[model samples]
Target: MSATEVKLFGKWTYEDVMLSDLSLVDYIAVNKAAQSFLPHTQGRYQMRRFRKALCPIVERLCCSIMMHGRNNGKKLMAVRIVKHAFEIIHLLTDKNPIQVFVDAVKNGGPREDSTRVGSAGVVRRQAVDVSPLRRVNQAIYLICTGARNSAFRNIKSISECLADEIMNAAKESSNSDLAAQLAVSAATFQRMIAQDAWKFLKYMWVNSVASDIPPLTHPWAWGLPVTASLTFSQGYAIKKKACFAAKVSFLHRINEHVLEEFYKDYRVDDAAMHVGESAARVILLH
Candidate 1:
């Protein structure tokens, strides 16, 4: 039989269901390449990288439904739930359920994500663009996750919950959007709090270093070793080069008067050791 002739569950027809989203047309993957009655590939695309994108989108939904909690490893159960959900979707919308599902996926996917930039002390969150494949995956994940959460400890069956979730998502009113937004907000809040706490600790560290410096010693003697140690411990190649440049700048800033005072008591070696000990102590505590 031709692919278009095949019916899902020998019932719902996969015809005239168009993907309207141009951006996800390549990644959404709604073709009849893997059309089947059961939607099981037995992990056929697992051997090759990124081959899962070739799997039918409906099969992908079924697979997504099989993840987490009691649903884990239960393919047939997932298939049944998805089939019933599609039936409900068709009943409610009086449209192609597959088209509704595609719309849901396109609408539910997140477009941007918060990411960290710059060095440890100067780090900041910036909104980054998400890949098309990741957007589709995240949309499916959120849809299934919301459905599962809604059905938990409730009278509603998972199929009904899934159907409702998809419908709401298609209309841009799903709890999946709220969940994704809250997740991103919580993560950003936590990171900001952590960064503020680190800044306070860094301020205290600078004060402690200044107070611990010997009276006749140059301030750079104590600060340089500790900074270098920290930089080397946590920095990348470019950061290391920047750290070396900073060391050179500090050396140039040291005048003949400061050098004379610095060499008077031979305290530079002791100061370097103290910095090493302090860095080691902080590392151990961390």
Candidate 2:
């Protein structure tokens, strides 16, 4: 029989498995010649530079699994572990194991990385493009490494951990969470600036007119109003690009009182005006 006629481990077939990512089609070598029941290439790819890219992707994964701890120098053990993991992936996801594995590689691969450059202690980090072959190699290495680490202390077996990691990686990866985190971070930075500004203004109010202004009544009597108003103004100004829900969420987190008053007094369009006037009255009066 030809190489294509053999099933992987006498069970899974590579018939319909295709690379959905067109850019990675050339880099990820998946074809009849590369598929085999036993994916051992016997280090022939290592004899020539760049020949490793022609090796089967599953063989690369098996080699990565053999990198650390007790699994080191044990190719058959790594192969058995990967085979069991693929079976688990098939049972849970009900999809082709090869397709899931390919998607995981596509999602987990890093496109760019930083390297140190320059000479004589003037070195700086510069971003560099990761070659396609290296990207696939790194992705397999990381997936196997993560599976090993997770299985180290936990009661879960390596096969289960590996299956879970591959399935999670294959899920659609997006930047929506990152964008939300950035919005919150920007709002936090604005709050810090508002706090500093409020402190300076409070100092000026007290020192400039100690005789004109009476002693304080309560802690939130005057300071909180001024601070909240200033925070709203500055945070709104800084987060104009953020979504309206994010802005409201920031305001609600910092001060619910200000948020309620915000809706009651000026709504949204006239918020800056109300905040400016409130702060001016508090600062200019004293």
Candidate 3:
């Protein structure tokens, strides 16, 4: 089916859509066509063309998406299509698809240099209708699509980088709503990055692939749930508990030094010996 026909499933075009917005057929077609064969230039041309077709749609549809409106579940349909388009371009052009898509989004969004006469001899510049929401949509789409099947470390690092950039932008931006949207995406990516990082560390800990966890210095790290009793059924739970017990013992031995110092100073075994006699001209300090 044609790209034009796919709009029938989307609320962005919102005219009598009988199907859900997140349609799979169009992307399936794009993937099939892309994986088949196309010259580099031809693939690039189609990528650009597909971008043009999808731009206005994203521009209009992203408003709802930014507001957290799902548009009757069609919100992701456009994103999926763009991802497939990128996949096609990668197959045909040997370029990293996310990079290409991100570059296009940065350079291709809006231009406001056009002018026209308005009802008289005076000229006025036409407004660029591509909003911040549109740009955010494009960036989020790229990030989410790139997250699939990729190495967790790679995705986590990229997400952290994007989140930092977005947070910086939010600080400098004047539009409150736009800044809030940027902040939301930044927070989302941060949570994902943190979770992914925890997963990475947890895998290392459980498999004994690395012994750096709980650190050689800090026994406190083992107090967390990774080595907790609930995780006992896990493969490394027994090891974790043993290591924690050892660290606790080590710490207790270290504390003995403190008790030895106190004993030497007081020369008495009383634990809470008062240092001062009852009120022989004692000075009171605030």
Backbone atom clashes (below 3 Å) for every candidate: 0, 0, 1
| RMSD (CA, angstroms), candidate 2 | 13.7
Worst-scoring 10-residue span by lDDT in model 2? 175-184
Model 2, residue 94: C-alpha shift (Å): 0.4
Highest lDDT: give the candidate number: 1
Ranking by lDDT: 1, 2, 3
Q: Which runs in model 3 stand beyond 4 Å of their true positions?
A: 1-72, 110-286
| TM-score quality measure for candidate 2 | 0.59
**lDDT for residue 108 in candidate 1, whole number 0-100:** 81
lDDT (10s digit) by residue, model 1, range 1-286: 5645867778666666677877787777666665556567676866787788888788899999987767688898898899999999989999778889989998887665667789979985664667888888998999999998899899999999999999999988835447565434433333323334224323333444334323222334424333455564453433433333333233334456654554453333332322333323222233
Could you list the CA RMSD of all candidates, in the order they appear?
Answer: 16.1, 13.7, 25.5
Best by TM-score: 1
- lDDT, candidate 3, 219-279, per-residue tens: 3454434434445466254444444343323322334554465346434233112211111
Question: Which parts of model 1 have CA positions greater than 4 angstroms off?
Answer: 1-4, 174-177, 181-286
What is the Cα-based lDDT of residue 98 in candidate 3?
36
lDDT of 2 by residue, 161-257 (tens): 8888788777844311122222223333333233343343334444443453333433233333334546766544333322222222223233455
Candidate 1 pairs with clashing backbones: none
Looking at model 3, the pairs that clash are 21-74
